[model samples]
Target: MTTVTTNKSEPGTTTSSGADLHLQNISKRFVDFTAVDDLTLTVPSGTFFALLGPSGCGKTTTLRMIAGLEQPTSGSISIGGQDVTKLPSFQRQVNTVFQSYALFPHMSVLDNVAFGLKRKRVKDTLQRAKAALAMVELEHMASRKPTQLSGGQQQRVALARALVNRPAVLLLDEPLGALDMKLRRQMQVELKSIQTEVGLTFIHVTHDQEEAMTMADTVAVMNKGKIEQMGAPRDLYELPKTAFVANFLGKSNLMYGTVLEDLGDAVAVDASGHRLVMPKNRAVAHSGAAVVGVRPEKMRVMTLEAEYSPSANMLTGTVLDASFTGVSTEYLVDVPGIGTLATFSQNMGQAPAQRGETVRMTWEPEFSFGLDGNEKATEGKDAL
Candidate 1:
């Protein structure tokens, strides 16, 4: 393995091996519309990084540019410290697995996996193809045709086909979109394991948030042709930097609030005339109008007669709706002035609130997150 030495690439700086993919100021335009706008990202070598966003958010375009399928209108792409922005698809050290799989219907799985190796006139095609199939745990099906295999098996074959080339980076553009939910989930784990075992950089483009969060070592949330935020899955989910990310990544109970005081350590907030408190460091904007968000599971429910704690943030509301999921009961509550707020209470043997019933929602002050007031929570609606 090549040691990662400190070196300045373009648009950003990082210490990584040549297998890392770097895109600096990359953009793509179609006439009056731009698909990717000044995008810059660095995927560390051998990491499972996911470009996550809704459809038409330029994730696919970015992957295409990296794979040399789509040329960027500006900027540069470097792999293993070599410039490949001007290179054709076949010339680049990258492999792509499309949603369609594109396997040869007439060929056996072993031949399908070795197709690229044969084209390149590589030696020991059969030997290498079997090795690749074993990586994806599909070695037993090498003799089967594409039509004879299940969707998951065929997807594994597609993966095997790409891996046989042993490219520096493998780009997967919704490669599991065709599988059923259960199988997609199973493949997500399998794909991540295979990438880790081979120590190959994998850049996955997907609209599925769960799949991305589940498999990606690092996730970049794309919005409107730009990266809204990027970090580890847990960090991005627990502390979203923008309203769009708060909503797009997961469910967020966004409530409009006014800052009452910024006391260095903690800030006092008032939402719907109900008092609230959040850490000052968590305040996106202090001493002004803001939108404070909390994850549903962070909140707890209490009876109207229960005494409130000054240290906890509390809201008074009427239960407008409730649905009992297996592990938790999701509730929609209507606070007088702040609108509807969602809460998820664990099913530790507690009855759900009924419609029109008055209730109180409480959560620790540390769990509340502040967002920019001017930006609507639906800022990511542009994605499909």
Candidate 2:
């Protein structure tokens, strides 16, 4: 796996046949509003990088700029060591596989894959197209028309079409958005494997968090045209840097609090009349107000009558709702001053707590994270 870096690469040092993609102080402004702010990023050669965000978050615009389909209103774009900001789409050595697939119904799969090569007057187009189809495991369907193929098969053909060109960079703009859940997941694995085998720099744009996390080596979460957070999937989910990331990437139970004490190794916060503690390294706000957060799955809920560990951060509340989803039971508990907090308990055959039942939720203090108190608590609520 090639490492994804935000730092600029040195001149004359090409990491792979595939080029590193860089955007320096990029911005796109429309007459009505600015679509992308001053954004800067570097995708290392041969890395599977994902630009993830909700709709209108400038991910697509960014992909378009990279593909030379749209020009940045300001800043520069470089692939490898060459600037391509003003180049036409065809001159950029970049190809895009869009969500719509854009296949011609009249053309056979082989013809579709060979179209680009044929347009470029390349010799041995048929042979290269067949090789591409084989790479996608659709060589047998080469002679079939796209209209006769399933959605997944067509998507693969679309991929094969783009791969046959051997572009320096491949941009995937929600390429699997149209596939059903099962096929989408299956394609995610296939796409990752194909990318690994080919060692091509891929920039994938998607709104689905699962899609981004499942396939990309690095994920950049965008909000309102700026990257809110960027990191490995596990790191971003475990230690979010902002309230928007914590809430949008997954479910986080956050409560407003004020920092009370800073122990050498930890920080204590008074949250809703309860003293909660988090590791010092995990605290973003050392003093004044803060937002204390924990993932639902990390919290353990039980009846108040049960014995509890004195060192754990504990909250007593009444169950507001309970939902059973086979593998785990999700409970919503209403704690005084803190509002409702969600908890997920694995179903170890014990019955789920009933609504209105008094319960105690406890978790290790180390599992908690602290964010700035000024951040909007619902900044990214229901974003997914």
Candidate 3:
């Protein structure tokens, strides 16, 4: 028989707000191909975390391991202090919302939600299903079949189905991938609000960086079967640990240069023929090759007619192209020494700089990051 348990805490008792999830040295292999390699991560209780990476980067594999749907070659999985590495998918205190809603076409919304309880032979299946529908604000659609519902409605049914189980954690695999841009944005806000209301631990997997940034309280950037970096969205964007994380998470303008001097808390780089000083968190290899990374938004374009000194990290270039996005203006500047730099400016009722106009680009020193290798620089140059 299906068992439903109500969660309760004493009225003034200090209730712990979150569940704790831990994965230790998780590794999975498919014959000669290793899908996940020595992956370890700790997700705090009640946190909405995302595993983000391109396809075949092992994000889905890691989620499966956590769900107990796939056995890891070596590792341990724990949820709320209980070891669940050897448990079956059904035995784990977790639920999953797959990409496809997987609703029954012929069944009413009520019957579709009652399916889980019915499979387990719960005594009050109908009552529980109604309550679940209410949780997702779909109780009024109880008699409607899956075909009668909108895409967002179907997704809510899936969420209601998963939440009805009251699992300690919820795993979602690209649940919004199928929706259109407008609907996707709407769902992002809805999902985040729902999660906050329920205070359930959620681990979502996706290749869309914006989705991850928008929905997750914490983000793990995965690459080549390994987690490159993990942190809050702002932290990862402002202080990226690696070049791959910087480039993959958002658009960045990478430059090739050699370190000219290490100025205690900052390092000066000779970018092509121009010298630029960047904030240094660690002592980078001085007097050697380096790569400087800067986000496109960090650059501001100034025409020759505009009044600005060349004291900052300034580069003169011709505007190769200008594209007007509603919220911002994007420019492609062809500079003599550093090649072409992609620049962006906010659209505050101002006209975009005209193409082929000579403009000066400047950025703050703190906005640039210095890395030792030339791989990212080479890749950026090749892309242009």
Best by lDDT: 2
Higher-ranked by TM-score: 1 or 2? 2
lDDT of 1 by residue, 1-384 (tens): 111121222222333322978888888999978899988777778777888998888899999999999999999999988999999999999999999999999999999999989998999999999999998888998899999999999999999999899899999999999999999999999997787678778889999999999998888888878888888888889998898899898788888888998777988888778888888777688878888889999998888987877788888889999998999999999989888889999899866789889999999999988887786966663445
Model 3 TM: 0.90
RMSD of each: 4.5, 3.5, 5.8
lDDT of 3 at 302: 80
How well is each residue in 73-172 modelled by candidate 3, as lDDT tens digits? 9989999999999999999989899889889899999999898889889999999999989988999999999999999899999999888777899999
Q: Estimate TM-scores for all models.
A: 0.94, 0.96, 0.90
lDDT agreement with native, every candidate:
0.86, 0.90, 0.82
Name the 10 consecutive residues with the lowest summed lDDT in model 2: 1-10
Candidate 2: where is the Cα deviation over 4 Å?
1-16
In angstroms, the error of model 2 at 218 is 0.4
Q: Enumerate residue pairs that collide in model 1.
A: 18-80
Compared with the true structure, what per-residue lDDT tens digits does model 2 show for residues 1-384? Answer: 112354222222334557889898899999998889998888888878899998888999999999988989999999998999999999988999999999999999999999999999999999999999999999999999999999999999999999999998999999999999999999999998888788788999999999999998789999888998888888889999798999989899999999999887998899978999999798789899999999999999988788888999999999999999989999999999999999999999886799999999999998999899998888888674
Error of 1 at 47 (Å): 1.0
Please report how far candidate 2 places residue 263 from its true position, in Å: 1.1
Q: Give Cα distance to truth, residue 33, candidate 3, Å.
A: 2.0
Q: What is the overall TM-score of model 2 with all chains considered together?
A: 0.96
